[model samples]
Target: MAGGRLSWAGLLKWSLSYVDGAGPSGAVSEEERRWLAEAVERHMMVDVVSRMREIALLMSTPPAVLEAQGITHDDIEDLLSELQVHVESIDMANDLHSVGGLVPVIKYLRNSNARIRAKAADVVTTVVQNNPTSQQLVMEASGFEPLLSNFRSDPDLTARIKALGALSSLIRNNKPGVSAFRLANGYTGLRDALNSESARFQRKALSLTHYLLSESHSDCSVFAQLGFPHLMMRLASSDDSGVREAALGGLLELARDTTLGNRSLLAEHDRLRRLLRGRMESIRTMTPEDLDAAREERQLVDSLWITCYHEPSMLRNEGLLVLPGEESFEQPPDVAGRFFEPMRRAAARRAPPVEGSDPGDGTGGGIVLLLGLAPDGRSNSPSH
Candidate 1:
């Protein structure tokens, strides 16, 4: 247990000898868990890793510099706390790099300690954020099942929130990979989070639900079978701004899915349509406060519109329709001024349509004229 660098070979020798002596007795008082964690992690053997993991769990002491002897319970606990953060940061970086060795990281995601569990989830999410390869490994490692199981009963708000966040991150990609079929079971986790008492949990669950509906080409029947639509509706009244935003956003995304769109998702189509129509209708009948709300609503609607229909012509045409008029004296010139230049650029690129050419023939020349056309087919020009 001297301060010499601990190698896997050396660790194996020490571990075997320690096991023979009935578990490193007499308190190698100076052995730090971090150093032990590092050594065991490097060994990568199931036995060594398992033993170190157990030791880590046992030694939950605060930080103290370990000598050659062994560490205290408080020292172990402190080291573990920092280890969780360090592992999370490293796992996230590995995710960024598409490294394939994240299974151990996922193993600790549901640790008994809520903070540790949360960090584990964060690390899993980091792996999924960009590294599809590692994501697959994690899924095959049965990470999601235990995670979902924890969701059913875990009382820690932070742990539940992290679990939800991790699920969201994983379902963001639905392509063929190790994760391709993992989402088949994702509905369980999503439903649990959606039902949680925490607003943050609901928001994260909804966000993940939205992603699953949109990204994973899975059948919407799973959600429908789980009564997800009802769950979403219930959350629409969340008092938290983030929760409300996510609930609405999730529903919006769900509504865009052709599979769900035709089903019950938009069964409240009339309500949603009326909601949208009312925004326009009430603009003419709005009070000052209503006008301000309408303006902000319009900006949100415009941003959503631009995001969905990103083509320049579509943007220019829609931009003009949504831009506030002088009659709407509350219009913000600064906002319109920012929007005008983009509209003009889009209009300039738009070519006037050729009489009979295929629109797909790279001849989007009608863009400018399309931009100029009034919503009512009347000219944008001043009356003579």
Candidate 2:
């Protein structure tokens, strides 16, 4: 096993034994554990790279050649699905893009076959998500127009969902893509999705709207003009916790907008004020178990209420009463701290070494690491 191919069945047996305190000579050494870890990683990487190569070849092949080979559209859809599975890795996404795979994938967004279009959207979504280079490439390829068209007019709900997801991935943290999306009237489709009867569609739409507003002030303004704030306020009280959370998140983003117009619009919504006050009162009366179960919603609503309080003129305009020195909201007592405090203290029992002393070697002088932290927490240095 050490020098040859590793089988999943063999690995599973070894892992079970290791967990059950059964190893070679009845004990597992650190060397054995490290070797197992490395073997598992190598095995996984080999499988992934092999599959990625196949998909890339298929993507780059000419359509006529594929036809001559008896590869139908269904086969291509299956390959695209496989590509989607692998594209969660940044290297796979980059490889796909480098092999001229992206253009055909974007063209498939308008494929007559619904399954192919959905799979293509899934592939695009997986490729562009959290990947800035892929996002920029998709935007430069004019990918937004097809995606928006499908998002607006696709008869298949599943395809529409995938298209909306792909659009979200394209616009996330990409300003140029957002501008293109807005110019193409993408917001109208999003608004329709938000108002749809399907909670799943509404949730995805709200999540995308949250990302849009969070990235671009112009998007927030456009959404506000489309009465997104009112829609969010209505959804904030939704029976579906997920929907409520998404709506509140969007509302919170809108409230935090630095532009006075966005803030003022939220402030002037009478329904929003009433919703905030009503949720606050309900939360104040809830039992501990209920609060614990609804902790995320409670936190979001609390944050929204506090935001309202911070905006003074907005509150005053609503004729909401407030007392001086009453702006602070008390946090719930940290009940879990009583159980964890001793563990934390035990972990911190060792005193800190002198500032100039190296903990690694007991050498004098601290190390000055010149590392620039990027948004993703990766080092920004060229060597990185």
Q: What TM-score does each of the candidates earn? A: 0.50, 0.66
Give me the overall lDDT of model 1.
0.55
Q: Write the per-residue lDDT of candidate 1 for residues 153-214, one digit (tens) a residue.
A: 67787877777666656645535432533544656767877877877778777776766666
lDDT of 2 by residue, 1-384 (tens): 213334654785677587557864546677776777777777776666666666767766878898899999989998898778777889778777676678888888887889999999999999999999888888888788888888998999989998998988888788788778778888888889988887888899999888887777667777888989888888888878789889999999998886757766776778888988776666667666665565667667767766766744333343222223334234668898887787677656756767876677735332334457989998866573
- Candidate 2, run of 10 with poorest lDDT: 314-323
Q: What's the CA error at residue 298 for candidate 2, in Å?
A: 1.7
Which of the numbered candidates is closest to the native, going by highest lDDT?
A: 2
Predicted model with the maximum TM-score? 2
